[model samples]
Every structure is written in C-alpha cells, then in structure tokens.
Target: MAGRTLIFTGPPGSGKGTQAAHMRDRLGFVPLSSGDTLRAEIKAGSDIGKQAAQYVQAGTLVPDDIITGVMLAAVSRQPTSAGVILDGFPRTVGQAEALDDGLAAAGRKVDAVIDFRIDDGLIVERIVNRRICKNCGATYNIRFCPPKVANVCDRCGGELMQRVDDREDVIRTRLATYREQTTPLIEFYDRRGLLRSVDASREAPAVESDVVALIEALG
Candidate 1:
C-alpha cells in the first residue's frame, strides 16, 4: 500500500522540529527535514553540498530548485511502507505547487499539512531564551522548560548554548519573514483541504497529543 505523507509548516520558533520528531516516533513516519538534509549534504562536501554551504553560512535560503531536488531525492529513497513527514520545506506557494507535482509524479500526495500556530509575541519570548545542545540537538527554553542542570543538556550532558539566530533581533527578522512568506503557504494548503492548525503554545506532550488526534481524524 502507498504510505501516508504529511507536511509541517510554521514560524521558526513554533517548535515544528520538535513536533515533527515526536510525530515521527508516534506515527512511525520517516521524518525528513530540509535543514537536516542540507546540513548533511554540506557536511559531505559534494557539489550540491558545496553550493548549499555558501547560502547556509550566510544565513540565506538555498535556491528553491536545489531544495526541491534534495527533497525529491530524499523521498525517492524511502521504502514505500515507511512514509514521510516533511519538515521545513515548501515555504512558498510556488514551492508547495512544485512539491505537489513532484509527489504526484511519484504516485504520492500529501495526506495533511499541520500548521503549528502560535502568537508572535510568545514566539519571540520562546526563541529569545532557547538553548540547544550542540551534541544531541536537544532544545530547551530557559524561561519555561530549562534543562535539569543549568547550561547543560539532559540527554547528552553536552554544553548548551543559545543559537545565534535565536537572538532577539534575528528572531524578529525571522518572524517577519515567516509572516510575509510562509503565511501564504499555510493558506495554500488550507485551500487544498490538507491543512490542520494546532495550537503550539501548550506543553510539548499536549501539542503532540493534538497532532495525533488530527492524524487519527484524517483516517
């Protein structure tokens, strides 16, 4: 049987990555994140990796064609039964259309697009104090959900550091960019009848439970 596919879109600090990871485990879907793919490719030092490195280092988006190509490649490698949960791609209407076309060519279509809705002010507050473990990528919000120990990762005992992009000014710019670009993509999926908006301001488990309910409802 053809497996299910889901897309996740939201503001930078809305916990899309965390939610996607949780859903991957709970739903048995392969989590494919564009940022992770690009980072892996760049680390591999291939031709495309070299090309993506420059943009990533400069804190700019890689070109759409490159990102789309990478996404298609990632999806092509998955087992038909495994399925996929897409994260951090198709940030615009054009990209969404292209994604649909690409999936159609592969005899697949998006089953749902979960949009993590959170207030801009809350997003700013969450990101400003966010700490990430460099070793395991565990994220903690200093203000709300700090690690068990100060400046340390509970999972790996690694040092925790705030991401440069999570600074107040940078986060504000990222949020502004999301409003201008990613917001339209939400409408695109909604119009296609594949969008599900979930409140992300709650605890992580609560958010995950709501997403699980949405998936079950889709069945």
Candidate 2:
C-alpha cells in the first residue's frame, strides 16, 4: 500500500517525533526529520549546509529559503510512490506555502497534517525530565520511560544527558517562539481541512494509536 505524505507538527516536547517513528514503522512513511537532515547536510559541507552552519554558529535562525531549499530537495529525492513523514519544516506560513508549491510540482501533496496538542506546563515538565542517548539519539522521559540504569542509555551504552534546550527556561522561551511562529501554520492547514489533533499528553502508545487512526481516517 502506498503511504500518505504526512506532516506532524506540535510543540517541542509534544512527542511528534516519537509518533512519527511509529507511523514510519507501521505505515511505511519515510521519516524525514528536518534537524537531522540539516545536520547531515552541514556535516557533508554542502553549499547549502555551509550557509545553515553559519546561522547555527552565530546562534541565529537559518533563513526560510535555505530551509525550504533543503526540504524541497529532500522531498524530491524520495520515491514518487511512497509516503513521507515530515517531522519538522514548514514551521511558518511562508514555509507551508512553499511546501505546497513544491509538493504540487512533484504531483504529490500532504495527505494529512497531525497536530499533537499539549499544554505549555505539561510540555515544560516533559522536556525537563527528558534525556537523550548521545550515541543513538534515542530520547527518554524520566517520568515516563526511564532507563533501567540511571543516567545511562538502554539502547546504546551511551551516557544520558539533558539537552540544553530542554531546560525549563529554554523550553519556555522555545514555547513562546513556537507559538509566535507556528500558530498561523496551524491555522493554514486547519483551514484546508487537512489538520487533525491528537492529545500528546498521554502515553506514547496511546498517542501513536490516535495518530494512526487519524491517518487511516484520512482515507
């Protein structure tokens, strides 16, 4: 079965990435994470990645054009017949419009947009307790999915560390930034009647179930 091109948008700690992985495993949607993709490009020292690296090194946001360029290129490389799980990108209305144009040119369009909804307070709590495996990039929430050995990764023997952005203050600021930038993007898809919301405050499996049901309903 051909999968659907899906966009998963939500607050930083809202489990969109986690749920996207579930979709990829069960539904065959190729997971294209914007952060990971950009990092790869930067590591490769590609021209576009070089520009993105400057912004990162300067502690500033990468230009929308560069971001859109990376996204379009990534999308173009994917199989025309397969579905994609977009973890990040189209973070604003401008990118969303650009994505629409890009997909249209490829004769494919986003089949569904899933918004994982959670309150700011809960998000802060979740992020603060979250830890990552430095070696494998696997995430764990101390309150929900803690590792058997404290401060150690279950998957890879790597030491678990809290991300700087997951600190309480940073999370609050990021939340503010997200609300400023992404609210309109949410409205954009909602108006198109392609947006569905799944409560992300629940457990991972429960949220995954809801996300899958919503996508299946899209058919």
Give per-residue CA lDDT, model 2, range 1-219, as digits (tens): 444688989988788988888878998888888998888778888788888899999999899988887877777778888889888778999998888898888778888888989999999887799999999999898998899999999988899999887899998998999999999999999999989899899988899888878988887
Which model scores highest in TM-score?
2
What local distance difference test score does each model get?
0.85, 0.87
Q: Kindly report which residue stretches of model 2 are placed more than 4 angstroms away from their true locations once superposed.
A: 1-3, 44-47, 131-142, 145-163
Output candidate 1 Cα RMSD: 3.5
Write down the TM-score for model 1.
0.83
Candidate 1 residue runs with Cα over 4 Å from true position = 43-60, 131-140, 146-163
Which candidate comes out best when scored by lDDT? 2
Native-referenced Cα lDDT, model 1: 0.85
TM agreement with the true structure for every prediction: 0.83, 0.84
Error of 1 at 118 (Å): 0.2
Clashing pairs in 2: none
